[model samples]
Target chain A: MRILIIEDDQVLAAGLKVGLGLAGMTVDLVGSCAQAGEALATTAFDAVVLDLMLPDGSGLDVLRGMRQRKDRTPVLLLTALDEVADRVKGLDLGADDYCGKPFDLDELAARVRAIGRRGGGRAAPCLTAAGIALEPSTLSATLNGQPLALSRREFAVLALLMEHPGAIRSKGEIEDRLYGWGEEVESNAVEVHVHHLRAKLGREKIETVRGLGYRVQVAP
Target chain B: MSSLRRRLFAILVAATGIIWLCGILWIFVGAKAELEHVLDTRLQEAARMVDSLVAQNGPAFAAAASAAATPERYQRQLSCQIWSLDGRLLARSGSAPDVSLSDHAAGFSDRRIQGEYWRVYTIDNPAKGVRVLIGDRLGQRDQLAVDLVKGLSIPAILMLPLLGGLLWLSLGRGLRPLLAMAVELKAREADDMRPLQTQHAPAELLPLAAALNNLFAKVETARRHERDVTAFAAHELRTPLAGLKTHAQIAMAAGDPGVRQEALRHILLSVDRATRLVRQLLTLAKLESGLAAGQSERVCVGDLIEEIGAAAQPSGKDVAVRIDPALRDFTLTANRDSLAIALRNLHENALQHSPEGGAVVWNVTPDGRGIGVEDEGPGMPPEEISQATQRFFRGKRQTPTGCGLGLAIVEAVLREMGGRLVLENREGGQGLRAIAVLPPATSPCP
Candidate 1:
């Protein structure tokens, strides 16, 4: 799992990235909203850890811009303001979760994971399908008691699909989930990934809905 | 000297001195005028008497005048001088020196004889055609006037000081009540806000006393409210903070991951409880101080309840909310933040007291005035109901997780909004029913 942290407090951001990296997730830290936007445009992250107060502008504006562009990448808002109005405003603006400052590092990690899992469309913390177990934090996927070697994109696609087991995700939502703010996308990018995933796994591992989207059905 | 009595006495003394001075001036002026008029009249009377004697005795009048001119044998307080027609000094009173009255024709004249002012009258008798002049010394007239003034002024001057002293004493006596009030005030502590005793106060100060009492009543109430809020905050935060510290320490010391996780969970729960307590404490303080009264907004009861239910569900309690369909869209003018705090506290209290997995129902009904939250938990004892509203007052049946400030916060909000909180047992004797009744909104939309 790739996580992006947008926080002005370099010390706290560094501490969080180190802690989360120790938990086996790749982490990238950005100190301002501009840097966050630039990073998002360039890289693909599983989740974005956004701080409400940024050096350039508010993290809410970034979140709102992301949502407006149909980017449903999980976003967790971190803030020092513990007022209820601020909480409501953050959540109402589509932040998956919020944690106030002076928070325990463990709690922040837990909340981030929770929002990440939810935004990935997974209901449970652990993802399992067809005797395959994938741990998002470890970014490791195993099939039939054997681990599979997969590229970053393949792993991301598998994770997104397995997160929502039966839910039909539109092509656009899948594209949004797969890409960050301004990543370039080929016309048949999802199709190419689906074909490749089929070639790697079983033919029926992933199903595509014509003119709508894709769904990862439960194995019968 | 700062006392009102002393001040009033001083004022009265000054006024009396002024009036006494004016009276003395008036008496002095009147005595001087009266003396001058009397001296002139006496001189004219003496001249008339001498002229009649001269006419009766003819040429022998001069000799007779000399015999009658004795100042020591006068009928009234008068002195006389007589001169012949040729302006020669003839007969003179012993008080008068040998000097001609005047060379002028017979009339009345004022002359300085021997450096003394004298009123002299000269009479021309038509029968004798002799200018008979009779003069009386003005000194005698002025002496009489001075004597009269002395008789009047001596007693008046002496009484002025006596009158001033009496005025000073009376003014001091009249202002004793004010002095007593000052003494009482000076003796009290700065923090003392008790009402002043109205006994012995003057009628003029009654309104001032009443205003002071009113101010004291308000101040006392405000002070009591502040104390209650502080005590509640301290009491409520103590246990949860201690628990948080303990759990954090345990988690830090634990070697096993499972033990550490469990300790972390406990720490989190403690932290959550502490946060809730702090929020409630702030809400209670705001409500008690009436700080939120001016910031009231229109809040929809249904939406508010839904939000509270969502927040309450995280406690893992079986919390249910049932809004009367008839009252679904009802709105009220209240401080939304404070109202939310109050409703959340009630929900928390219910969740705590209800058996695990037991239903904690939040029923919102339109009590003629406003919305009411009726909880179903183990209701408090009848005697403890009133005490529960007080800060830091915990009932025997209260849950260990509670900070005993839930009902107190509710009470404070209700009071700040000019509302009331009623606690009673549920109909089935199942649990407590806490109702927060607010004033009816001026307008309601269904």
Candidate 2:
């Protein structure tokens, strides 16, 4: 898989190239927007790592130019500015992901690979963890290769947690995902769902971190 | 002593006095003149009657005068005297005393008799070679003058207070727009930066209100910019610093020594950068927030300098602190946190700019009215001193030490504390000197 990096800082770009290259990807580095444009015209890449600020112009311009040419390649934006408005602008420009500067090289490589896998159409349409597989496309789940019939509420609760594996999804977020807009949720709906999910899947499948929320660790 | 109300009131009172004096003089002079004219005309008619009677029957004129002497007939009306060309007294009116009129036989004359002023007119009868002298007691003339003055003065005296009251009321009404503005200002919160709503303001005061609102708009923009910078710095620094620490931990757990050493070096650089970034962020936040509003405490300048010196000593620089005995005992009312931040920035700048082994001196002394800080470093050139306190500005010689926000923060803190910070060269070109002049405290120094 080939990934293009558009960054102004040579040191950061070189570091990213080495890191992402080590993650089983071919990396092409370009330091300016002009060079990025030239590379995009001559080559087909699975994903592009774009820095928001460039010496020649803004990365938003590059993103817009790509979209104008009907290019659907996933673009991830890297910026030092963490302002809310800037993030909104990058997302509105059709960026696949946004990461701020001084990011973990591992995190960056993972995002790049995810975007690449998503672009390749081989990315998982279903999330499987700890003996349970959730088919997001059909809003269905199977345990041990057998269909596990669940209520609509249980399916929603599991889907939200599966979307962000290893992350502690808060109770409030689970409720929002389970309930429709303006629907008054039962105060203990998430707890009830977690109780049912644990009873159906195993007790150790869903772990709760105190003072935070619930997480489903991706099974090794 | 120079009150606007008092000055206006005095002006009005003086004008009233001048007008009253002029009116009194007019009454006195006009009444006397009119009275003299009437007396002259009456005297002429009396002389004509006496002359005709004496010519028709010379000795019978005395009887005629006597016949007219009835008190009821004249009704306390008139007094008259007649003198001949030979200066002999002629016919006189009813019980006219032997009081002589003036010997001057023509024109009008004023005289005093028995403490009463008289207006006398003398008319010459050339055909008869006789002079008729007519006189009226000055009391009657003075009485008319007094009556005229009383008529003019009564209403004026009665209306003076009313006029003053109206003037005061109108003056206050004229200033109502300013009062309304003051009331609105007093009602606002300290952090409220809303523009003043002055659409209903008086036309003359609208410009002043608009200018004030413009100033507030600028202040609000500046404050928003500072807040954005601080927030951005904090958020941007956090993830990188966290990643650096995590990577260093990962490297330390690795078995390779070269890789571990490189990771440690990277970690230290990242830590240093993070620390510098956090410090700048805090300083910027402190400066932007200003001194805590409504806080006033007695702060000792000398002790503050000592505290800063001790804090700087940990940075391994030999920072010397000097305190003038007079300033050591002096204290000022300020927010302690803000004052300490301002002083620390100055001391830190001095320390950073000095050579490795060179001394950084913090001199807190009375500068006739305030405290001064003197340092021993390659001082900023004269041209660069003015721009030193601008945001992100560094002198040509001092760019490498750190981010150039030190002096800017100092300037902001001083401004919030109601003091001025002045930068100048030390004597003999040793280094830079900064002076902070605080307002004199009310209580005497102990």
TM-score of 2: 0.45
lDDT for residue A143 in candidate 1, whole number 0-100? 80
**B235, model 1: CA deviation in Å?**
2.7
Using DockQ, give the best candidate's number. 2
Local distance difference test scores for all models: 0.70, 0.70
TM-score: model 1 vs. ground truth? 0.42
Task: Give the candidate number with the greatest TM-score.
Answer: 2
True-vs-predicted CA distance for residue B157, candidate 1, Å: 8.1
Off by over 4 Å in 2: A1-131, A134-220, B1-14, B34-77, B83-90, B123-131, B193-265, B272-446
Give residue A148's error in model 2 in angstroms: 16
Worst 10 residues of 1 chain B by lDDT: B70-79
The C-alpha interface RMSD of every prediction is 15.1, 6.5
Q: Across residues B1-446, which tens digit of lDDT does each residue of candidate 2 receive?
A: 68656676678777877988897788778876886677567655654555565556655545544443335533544456666778777777764555666666676787776676666666676766666555666676567667777887888889888888887777677777788898999999988989888878988788988998999999998898786456434434543454474455546454557656656665666566667767776777766775244476887777877777776646565555566666567677777787887888888777776666666555444445657777777787898787677665544565333455777778888777667789988878888788876655522255
lDDT of 1: 0.70
Docking category for candidate 2?
incorrect
